[model samples]
Structure formats: C-alpha cells, structure tokens
Target: MVRLDRITTRGGDAGETSLGEGSRVRKDTARIEAIGAVDEANAALGLLRAQIAAAGADAEADAMLARIQNDLFDLGADLCVPGAEATDARTGRTRLRVSDAQSARLEAEIAAMNAALPPLASFVLPGGSLAAAQAHVARAVVRRAERRAVRLAAEETVNPAVIRYLNRLSDHLFVLARRLNRNGAGEALWVPGGARQG
Candidate 1:
C-alpha cells in the first residue's frame, strides 16, 4: 500500500518542481499547470463521488467514479513527463503516450450518458444537488485546463490525447451533472421568467 504522507516533499517551495519522470522544472511550467488542472479536476470528482456515496446511490456509479480517479492520475503522469516518455518503475521501460483508445473510450462514455438525458432547449443553470453543481464546476475547470494545455502545445510537443481527453472529460461532466440531478431527486432550476417552449 502507498503511504499518503510520503507524496509531498516540499520540493516546490522555491518555484521549482520535479516531474513524474524525475526532471526538475519550474512550478509555473506549462506541464505543471496541465498536471495541476487534472489534479484539481480529480479532486472535484472525488467530492462528487463522496456525495453520491453518502446519498446511497447505486454502486455502479460509485465504481465508475473510482475508475475515473485512477485515470486522472495516469493523465497527470502523462502531462508531467517531458516529451511524453517516462521510465516506468514497474516495467523498467519508457512508458508514455495517452493513446487514442483512451480518448475514444471517453467519447463513448459521454455519448452513452447523453443518450439518456433529455434534449436541452436552453442554457443550463449549473446548480441542483451538491454533486451536480460540483460536477459543473469541475467541467468548467477542465475547460480552463484545456486552454492551458493548448497554450503549452504552441511551445512544446504535447500528446494530442491530452487535448482530446480534456474535451471529452468536459462533456462527461456535463452529462454527469444531469445524471446526478436526476438520480439525486434534485430539480433542474430554470432561470426566473425564462422563455418556455415555443
């Protein structure tokens, strides 16, 4: 088992940090922002998972969220490593690249979830259950992260998979918010005096 306390070493106090592959870089590096964004998104998802678990939702959703948490960790690793190549501790080989297959999977998940949701006629107000609201917040943060990654791409070689991942993840979170609102018995709030169906 991994000890939680061993993760932080205060190595970033001087505005310098180490990547997952053991290369030291500045804290404000594009790679670092990309990784940090994934971390923030993962934490937001954790909050949603905890809310769902506490509300006694089905085990399947909770299980999915757990898998997402792990995937985000891998994503962070991918972003942190330079040139998308890192020596794998377990395999003793350079393991990198996020893979087109992973991006496809996220797309598939988003499609599946959106299929069950009602068609949207108006802009959504991002609030309902605590979980739904937080999911929306996560979605927005992921968009910001995507922008940062794009900026980095302009100056460096970034894995295209990272871009695709963020795009799909935002879609996933949007659908997730709808799902949580439905499942948690929270009503979707329309804006006051908003236009109705034509």
Candidate 2:
C-alpha cells in the first residue's frame, strides 16, 4: 500500500506531476486525464455506497462497491505508469497493471445480478430508488472513465485489461442499479416520444 507522508506536497503546483516510475509529465496528459476520471468514478461509488447503507439495502451490493473502490485504486496506480515495462524508481518494482481476471470477475458478477432483474422494455432514466439513482450516477462516471482510457490506449501502449475492466465496471454498475431498484419494480422508463407535444 502506498503511504502518504504529506497531504500538502504542492507537487502539481507547477502543472506537472510525478508518475509511478518517478517520471514527470504534464498534469493534463491523457494518462493523467484517465486517472482523474477513474478517481471520479470511484468517488461516485463511494456516494452510492453511503446511500445504500443509509437505506439498508442489500449487503452484497455494498461489499461489491467496496471491492470495486479498491480495484479503482489499483487502476489509478496502473494508469500512473505508461506502457507495459516500467519499474518504480523508488521501490524498484514493476508498476501495477490491471489484469484480465479483474474484468472477468466483473462480468461474472454482472451476469449473476442481471439474472434476477426483469426485462427492460425501455431505456432506464436513472431512477427508482435513492441507491439506484446513485448507482446510475456511478455508471455514467465509469463510462466517462472508459472513454478516457480508450483514448489513452489509442495514443500509447495501454493494457487491454484496463479498457476491459472499465467497460465491465460500467455494465456492472448498470446491473447493480437495476438490482438495487428492487429488481426493476418501478424503474423510470424512457419513452422516446412520450414527452413530445401531440
């Protein structure tokens, strides 16, 4: 686990930050952008966790979110180092990287959770219960993170697992939202023309 010795390092006060390998880059780089998006998504998950806990929702979902939050930290560390070969300057250890196993686990859990939900006849409008609403928010954030990761991959040698995990995480959040909505009991379905004036 990485320890924070100081909270106010002012490291990025010059618009540059250090990577996992001790290399410095502009804070606005694609890698940093991707990491920022992932961090935001993780924060959204935290909000969802709090909402679910307050509502006394399912314990499994809470545990899942906690695990995903930890996974997001790993992902942030992975994005800190570019390419497939980078040894940390301080620890002299290979930088962290997302793996296929993480994505695979998300897929499996998504399948299991989705199995209990009803068929969706229309688009979801990001509402049902408070917990579900927050889950939807988290899902949207994860989608943004996935897009940023994809853009980074196009420019550099990104691990396929990173993109894969983001993709699966969004799907998992979607299914989790549905599941938390009491298995689609009263979801706010979208109607394409229902809002138009007749």
Clash totals for all models, in order? 0, 0
Error of 1 at 16 (Å): 0.7
Question: Model 1 over residues 113-171: C-alpha lDDT tens digits?
Answer: 77877777666788898778888998998888888888888888787888888888888
List candidate 2 stretches off by more than 4 Å. 86-92
lDDT of 2 by residue, 1-198 (tens): 668889999888999999876799998999999999999999999999999889886999999889899999989988888786556566788777788889899999999998889889888999889999989999999999999999999999887888999999999998998898888886889988888958
* lDDT of every model, 2 decimals: 0.78, 0.90
Output candidate 1 Cα RMSD: 3.9
The TM-score of candidate 1 is 0.83
Per-residue lDDT for 101 in model 1?
78
Residue-level lDDT for 39 in candidate 2: 95
